[model samples]
Target: MMSRIPTDAIRACVEHTGWTEQEVRNVLGNVIAETPDALLEALPEVIAWAKRIEDSAALVSIMKELPRGVLEITWNGTEPAIRIRPSCDVRQVPEGWEIVLPDEKRHAST
Candidate 1:
């Protein structure tokens, strides 16, 4: 039987990133399925990224473009970065900031 997704983790993601509950579930579900604790484990970095960006709408758009799988948050350098397995392509928004997006969204109407 499949295990349920953790509500606390979902809440954290939603609170920090401004993504709807279903969006959070879609983004993190695959990773949580592979590793039950993955969402909780990654929550800190996710929150950090959200705080660093300080734009809920942008974060929501970015999350929407990510593939439906493991969400990877990295802090190996001066800033935090997020990506998913089989990394997506990136494009610059009108504000001149680059953001990653799945292939479909790469050319879809913004």
Candidate 2:
């Protein structure tokens, strides 16, 4: 089952970051544009999975994409299906083998 970015999640972000709803909407608008509803729905799970893999940088980067740098989701041709682009230091998470990465490429995964 697919999950979506909840209104409360966005509200929480706005409250924590002190950003206006419009600002949040602008970023979310771009996000929706790129991947559409399904991926956005999967955002929370994707983030949790990223945390499980210790890819905090990626999570932060995804959140910081005001003008750009937004997490770009794509099909990996696998069951994990969704792939996040602009992933810096790619590391594979065993569950569904999702590729998670930090913001910068410090070391290459072998």
Candidate 3:
């Protein structure tokens, strides 16, 4: 998948979103140039298609209604989807937020 951080796309997002172009450019450029592994690890979390984490309260309600266990959230990004293992007990998901289930223990994948 093509990354959204391409120069023209980033410039577009900045102009469309009314964000500081300089800030966006610096953050995007530095992440691409400095720490590749960190960027790879976090790419799934903050892609262009992530259901804007800006709406947490509503998401909490949605999570509360869904049956407990693993949920796969498909968003637009290079990879296209992210699977989250949320804590079983959560009633409402914090909106615009996908909190990593606190009790989730990451087992090394083979």
TM-score for each predicted model, relative to the true structure: 0.35, 0.28, 0.25
Better of 1 and 3 by lDDT: 1
What tens digits encode model 1's per-residue C-alpha lDDT throughout 6-108?
Answer: 6776687788778788866655544433355665667567556654556656666876775453356777777557655455544678987554656665456
Q: Which lDDT value does model 3 have at 15?
A: 70
Tens-place lDDT digits, model 3, residues 1-110: 22544566556656754557675555455454345556545544544433254345556666666444545667686433544554433345657444434443323211
lDDT of 2 at 83: 36
Question: Which parts of model 1 have CA positions greater than 4 angstroms off?
Answer: 1-4, 30-34, 46-110
Off by over 4 Å in 2: 1-4, 32-110
lDDT of 2 by residue, 1-110 (tens): 11255677767656754668676555555443344466566555544453444455655565564223224544467523333456543455766334445534324322
Measured by TM-score, how close is model 1 to the native structure?
0.35
Judged by TM-score, which candidate is best? 1
**lDDT over C-alpha atoms for residue 77 of model 2:** 75
Name the better of 1 and 2 by lDDT. Answer: 1
Question: Model 1 shows how many backbone clashes?
Answer: 0
lDDT of 1 at 81: 75
